[model samples]
Target: MLGLVGVDVDGTLVGTDNRVREDVWAAIERGRAAGMHFAICTGRPAVGNALEYARRLDPDGWHVFQNGASIVHARTGESLSAAFPEEALPGLLNMAHERGWLLELYTDTDMAVTQPGDVARRHADLLGIPYRPQPPEALEGTVVRVQWVVPREDEGTVTATPHPGLDLHPAGSPVMRDVMFISVTRAGVNKGSALGRIAQRYGFGMDRVMMVGDGENDVTALRAVGHPVAMGNADAPAREAARYQVGHVDQGGLIGAVDLALGL
Candidate 1:
């Protein structure tokens, strides 16, 4: 039996419209009634709309945000775990500037980009939050993670470069197929590590956990759980990483995945 369930936002939980279907919410409520906990694990920042989704799903539950760079309580806003490696910021910023890449730096309070672009504007619009056009040095302090949104064609080149203290993972966005995400975090930070922490806190092992996702960044968390589910619309890498595959997000895949997890 599964004790905890972790779900990715964006493509996995909600569709391009960013709305969670009624049936999916119903399934989550059913899972909660059966004593199962749910966590909103995403590569999104911990602040803004991400927290709103987390509270809506499980107000008292843990939230794994920024691709596991931050783990916090949804309702109380207490930090269970957080990582902000300032040392990696300089190198990441330098690379972004040198490569002329549009980079967004995320803090607990705000998200800023060195220069605004279509991707940054879309992100801000999606979160319904305002972003500042600040240089990397100006947006120092309390940086949780950095992301570079590049054209899909440039993904290979951007990811090929290496930074000393940063770990890079390239992921695709369901809303923007032409774009690719280069997520940069502290060397050891990833969703898998954060899921392990959540399991430890609740006294459950990976074998008792179920996770659902549909993107490249979600691969680590999917592999960390016993019941790994990939949405039918997921990228090839994500589908290959999962133990089971369900319908697309538009077809209520989250609902199906949860039902399968609970053996309902």
Candidate 2:
């Protein structure tokens, strides 16, 4: 029997605009009723501000947040947090200031984002999370990860911040713009590790789980599960990782993937 299900938020399950449809929620409810353990394995940080639908997507299952930097029970909020190496924080901070790009820092309980622009404010309003404008010094005390939100059409120009020991890479859901988000975390802190840990903790075999997504950060989770599905709108990397590629989210790709996974 399929014991667990791991689905990404942006592309595979929801549409490209970051909203969850009623039909998809029905699918989640049905999956739960079918004795399948459900989890939202996303790069979104628990400490940072989230979207409105995000709150609804959560509160029902395990949250693989911060791109797998933290794993927590959504209802109880009990979690295991892994932070970046202390020795590397200084360089990361310096790089952020040099680039003048907004940096979002994530801890299990605390969050701070610098250079709050209009886009950030809009996102904050949608999620109803109060944005506390804090400086770099606020980043002290065991930061699990950092993220960069680049402006539209400027993703490619955002040069990589050299962190030999830290892992820095781009992240987002199917709904997000292409290549606009960059996530930074410790090498071992990611969705793949989180998925593996969640499966082992719940006594589910790796082969019984499904990981579906359409972004680069999702590559880890996609490779970890028995079936990795790429949305029809998935970028090249996501398509490469997935064993099966479904139609676009707006076209009811997730419903199709569910049927296909179970041979329904």
Candidate 3:
């Protein structure tokens, strides 16, 4: 049986409606009862709805947030987060300013945006937080990740830009499919790396880990685990990386994953 399970948030756990089904919750309870640990691995920062979900999933376990830059213990509030390469900031800041794109910066528990408007408001809603725009410099903790919130059409432009010493993981929420959230972290810091750390911390080999996800950012994690399950609605890259596939999130696909984890 798998010793650990890492799941993605938006496209894999919750659907476009942004809600977890009762059946999904019940499956998690069953998995926990069987002694399998679950972890939230996502590109989102650890705050607001995301933080709540982490605690709810495994109150005392560690979660991978900010595309793996922020690894926090939901119960103890201990962080094993990575630091943002400070040198990459000026170039990114300049890119955003030059293009007038909505850029966001994140610490372990807070986030700030450079441009705010309808996009920001919708993003805030998606994040299950109040719409509050603050300068990036105003965030109180160590900044670990940066993100570009742009229209789907602008995705290529953002990705094409040169960002040395950094890595970009582009993801889309079903809630706002036309908007791409491009998460930037220090080079080689991604969901796969973080999941590896989480497994090592628990003394589980990568072969003993299972990961379920449905987005571009999830590819790393899918490749990191022995049993990599992709959602029915998963992106092409995710599907290509996975060893197994489940139903859609809206259809309680996690229930199948939970059963698989428990060897049912």
Candidate 4:
């Protein structure tokens, strides 16, 4: 039996247009009702994007965030595990500053960013999210995940323009494929590590876990989980690794998968 089920938020749970379809939400509730466990396994930060899911959907389960850099229990706000060494930040942030990328910082308890602009606002709006802007001083806590935003036309800049000393990556949201951004972290921190932690903590085999994603960052999860589902809108690698190509998020792709998983 699939003991735990992992979901990708942007394209799998929410739609390419950033709308969270009612059917997908219903499917999640149905899976929970059926006694299948759920987790948000995405390239989003441990406490950044995934925290919202923890607060709303996975209140009963743990979340694997930052591509598996960290895991936390949503209700108690207790961290089950954390990845990333302190030494990795200078190089990580340096790459962002040099690349002119919008860097978003996250930790187990807090999240902040140095800047917010028109495009960023549009992204938040598209995702149906509201954010109160803050200044650079807001980065007061340790950062678990760091992200960089680049224009789609400037893709080569992030890939080659950043300081070679640091590690960085382009973060793709299958639903938001037109917009461009990149996320960077220590070498070993990613969803695979997060899944390893969860598998150890729960004493479950890889066969018990399943992941769904639709972005470049989700490559780790799509490769690591027992079942990796790619939304129709996914980036190249995510689509390639996904064992199944469900419909688009707007069309209840996730709902369909759940029905099939439960044989409903």
Winner by TM-score: 3
> Which pairs clash (backbone N, Cα, C closer than 3 Å) in model 3?
none
Can you give the TM-score per candidate against the true fold? Answer: 0.94, 0.87, 0.98, 0.84
| lDDT of each residue in 32-53, candidate 3, tens digit only | 8889889999988888889899
Candidate 1: tens digits of C-alpha lDDT, residues 1-264? 789999998888878777789889999999988889899988887777778888988888887988888788887777755556776777777777798888888776566787676777787766657755666667655777788888999998888877677778677766777888788888888888898898888899999998899988888998899989999999888999999999999889999888997893
Which is the winner by TM-score between candidate 1 and candidate 4? 1
Q: Rank the candidates by lDDT, best first.
A: 3, 1, 2, 4
The CA lDDT at 173 in model 1 is 62
Per-model C-alpha RMSD: 1.7, 2.8, 0.9, 3.1
Candidate 4 weakest lDDT stretch, 10 residues: 161-170
The candidate maximizing lDDT is: 3
Q: What's the count of clashing pairs in each model shown?
A: 0, 4, 0, 3
TM-score ranking, high to low: 3, 1, 2, 4
The lDDT per prediction is 0.82, 0.71, 0.91, 0.67
lDDT of 2 by residue, 163-253 (tens): 6866666765443444367877888677888988888878988898888787888888888888888888888888999899887888877
Candidate 4 lDDT, 10-103, residue by residue in tens: 7777665656777677887888788777787765654444567656666857787665556877777667545346666666566656756666
Clashes of 3: 0
Lowest lDDT 10-residue stretch of candidate 1: 132-141
Q: How does candidate 1 score on lDDT?
A: 0.82
Off by over 4 Å in 4: 45-52, 81-85, 91-99, 123-132, 135-138, 161-169, 174-178
